[model samples]
Target chain A: MKETSLQNGLVERYIREVGRRLPQKQRDDVETELRSLILDALEARGDAVVDETPEEAQVAVLKELGAPEEVAGRYAAAPRYVIGPRLYDAYVRVVGIVLGAVALALVISTVINLFQTQPEGISILVTVGEFILQYISAAASALGFTTIIFVVLERTLSEEDLKDLKDETEWDPRTLPHVEDHDRIQPVGMVVNICLTILAIVLFNLFVDRLGIVFMQTEEGWRTIPMLSETALKTYLPLWNISWVMALALNIAVLQQRRWSTATRILELGVKVFTIYVLARMLAGPVPWLPFSSWAGDGMQIVESLLTQVFRWAMVFGIIGTVVEIGQSIYRMIRQR
Target chain B: MDEIINNLILELRRGTLMLSVLSQLRERQYGYSLKERLAEQGMDIDQGTLYPLLRRLEKQGLLSSEWDVSEARPRRYYVLSASGQEVLAAMITEWQQLVKVMEHLLPQA
Candidate 1:
């Protein structure tokens, strides 16, 4: 083999470089093994040409062995992928979308607030600063919440669960339905409807003056009157409130389910039936649908009867329609099965 | 295209690399000799990959190693442990089953 100083120095330098990177316990054994390997390759006849100098052959052998650090790296334990490679992209995307959504909401609120109030220079600056602070805080909290969820999932979920998650993401063409535009749930529309429904509930229950009609001035700016009678409201408001909340729960379930599943359909049907029941009860009870003055007498009585009949028929129609929908859903589910 | 194929090839070979090495490690062999033996059998393992893989297998108690300074050039020779032999046998059966499946699906041109 090469007894040359050049070859010896090169081997020592390479081994030392690798040894430096390796953990202390593994260092000696790995270094010894490497040195023997390098020397064995140098000694092997076919590996080194007879014409080449010992140093040249040693250099060639070292090159063939690849980088010293690279050789050491293979022995090291693989990177601690806490979230794993498969889930990392999804984690990033979820965090980004959640945080971005928070930021967007903050931006929208700031813009709405700006429109409401005329901003003098210092006041505008202060408002912008406040918006930025709120934006960062909300975004940070959202990101933190999402990250904790993912980390917990990563730690707690079994390999099978993780594999199932991976399969869900991969999305096979064979698994997809034949229908085009497969995503049937209108998430954006549902969100807008949910928000509007919430606003309605809030106004009806809390800010009744903001809702209904505004009458003429009564020496206190303008007089606003409640559309429904107090007795009617007392009787029906609680029932209607419960119905609204149930409707909200139903929509949220729909939004989460994303498509029309049997469970969600049943929930929708239940909410609809419950709502119609409440409406029917309200119609039958002492609360008048429209508040009217007793001075109108016969005219008021006729109008009241007409409205009552209209409401009863509407309730009946709603019940029938909902029942038909439930029947249709059941039929569809049976066909699918 | 080349990089894709290269990566594909590396991935395909990754699991079998350990199996192939363990098969030859039934007999005591030093790092360079083991590399040469694998090459002779058409398993073109990188030398950098081999040396560390041997240490890893040893660390996992699949292989046992001893330094023989009795020879002119002191060599750390490695041989398969009892556990390693059992693992290797199981791996071989799995590999044979995989080959049969592959042969059935991947017909020759």
Candidate 2:
């Protein structure tokens, strides 16, 4: 509340009520404007506040001005909701899933602990209760953090960032993602998926030799083993690098498509088939993976034997993975109809 | 029926209220004086609505405001921005077209 000799107590209270609802930065200015407006009216009434004030006149003025909340409501830039109304449903879903996961983990841990420790039932119950409290607080903290993030984004978003939100605005067809619909292409989710794919490529290309069993480690350095054969890598390096680049381009195309159409699905299927083709060729002869020389000193037979086993497992896994993925792709195409 | 008409009438006036406030602020006037100026021109603007509308216009870069404590009872005076003059001119032309169109559409007295 802000006022001078011109503004009366009643108007000050009204301004205070209205000021509390306004943004912190605008509150003082809003209060000042409200006080000045009301005072001007009161001054017109001739010593209504500073002198013997007429209750009827003050009541009439306040009545005409309307309720403080109603007045304050007009000044609000956006309505307040739990994490704001636009993101409310998504927030609820995320919170519900997290809480559900916590509950499931709690149940599993309780069951496992009871069987393993064979603890007293009362103590177990007490521990479970404590765990439940902790879970509830964790879920609440997660919700609070999500709400803060969304609120900040809601307030700070530029006109361009809000382009996706406009009902009538036309999105650039070229920049569309591989997923269709607002839910399917959930902007953040699609970006994250693309980022993860890039990360996988980087990790594999950079750390190709240091991917398997660690042996003889004591702070300084360990003899790190390679799972994939360097010879195989050298053989496939050209094709592998080309395929990686092509796959990255496909992912980029999907991002541009913005929706999973037949084009994206076909592209994905082609990439999968290409991968399976490479793997099948590798399986026919030698898989790049074998036990290192350090692991088996001149044990060529041991290396060959282990390599066969690794090759068999890869074939099985590869076939199953491809079949499932191709099946999913076909299913998605059919379902689109 | 009367309530519905009243609500509709309020909606009709709401758009003009900003224009009315802007027009009055062409000359520097504090909150009350601005209201009084509008009232003189036959628009009984609400203080709550007028003050917020002034602030909103200021935010939109249409009106500029300053606080003056020179006299008893410090007051914030508002004046139209340079951009506001340009917008007001365009809006006046648009408003005239709207009035002409409405007059044609509306049932004759």
Candidate 3:
């Protein structure tokens, strides 16, 4: 009787291990069927004798059936990989492009800082080390974020959407963009836009100190004057971050769909309006330029005034450009309808 | 060379394994009884592979199963569905044509 109980305990443990991995809907049925099958196999092996089946015989039968995980894996409904074959190509391309953009941005920022600081000897090496560390962290996070987007896409994209992506027979030449079609999403342009937007986000959020006009000064060597007043930047950084992130998300959506739709165009219109509001507020708020009078004495007074003029003109042009973009978006949306 | 041939053989058999399992389910059979029946006919399959495949086939609507509790221990019996019979018939016709094609294509042993 004790031996029989021991044999049943071994079988019960194995069943539990497999059932724990199976989906809830199938777990009970699979466990019941598996128990019956195991007992049947044991009987065939002459180990199901009422009170005498040895524990070793039970183990042997279970081993032949295979490991619990392997058995459960065969029963899994979902594919094992986070990003399956359907989205694999897009995932790889997006990660490569984003990581490349991040590395490029880091190198550009480091070069700009190097020129501004005129770092000598050990300082130059320290700057390069910092650049390397920043690139590693940026690239890692970019890969992670891109993977998460693809994982979400893998789960959410319907079969029809995937088929549209891959099936060459489904292609219709009539659907191709005309020569003057402004709504046709240019892949190369989208990539460049995404890269630039990401670079802006990284620079504004992380390396705001490096945004400045570099000037040569006699006797004092290279003088780095930090542009953009600290109070203004601190007030507006969150808004800028939100706008850039929204732009990044919109660009990714267009890239995935391979063309601009009415929905995305409407989204673009909304984003541009938000951006205009932020720019208008910044212009109306305190002067964003950092004047050099306190640090540079009376000799640099003219340079400070020239910098102020340049900053105001740049803001004016930025607002004008965004307004023109918003007009284009509305035109496209109306025409597309 | 032997390993390569073994793999090639395995690949060839993998497709036909589903047909072989389906053909036997014209009548109802419990899991072990079905496994033993196939083994008797010289088509030995692992319990691990056969059992999950049975569940998958049922999920695909090719087979229907029921639990018979009248026995000493309950056994789940699987039989061919109506659509399963249609698929089996079509598959048999395709297999026969494939066999004829192979016979003509291959040099006489």
Best by DockQ: 1
Model 3 CA lDDT for position A28: 98
How does chain B score by TM in each prediction? 0.96, 0.94, 0.95
Candidate scoring better on TM-score of 1 and 3: 3
Ranking by DockQ: 1, 3, 2
TM-score each candidate: 0.52, 0.48, 0.58
lDDT, residue B81, candidate 3:
100
Better of 1 and 2 by DockQ: 1
- lDDT digits (tens) for residues A119-187 of candidate 3: 544564466578879999999998998888888887788888887787577678999986787767889
- Compute the lDDT for candidate 2: 0.72
Interface RMSD of each: 0.9, 1.3, 0.6
**In model 2, how many backbone clashes occur?**
18
Q: Which residue ranges in model 1 land beyond 4 Å of their true spot? A: A2-8, A45-48, A78-83, A86-125, A133-337, B1-6
Error of 3 at A6 (Å): 5.9
Q: Give the per-residue lDDT digits (tens) of candidate 3, residues B1-109.
A: 9999999988888888899999999999999999999999999888888899999999889999999999877899999999999999999999999999999999999
Residue A249, candidate 2: Cα error in Å is: 52
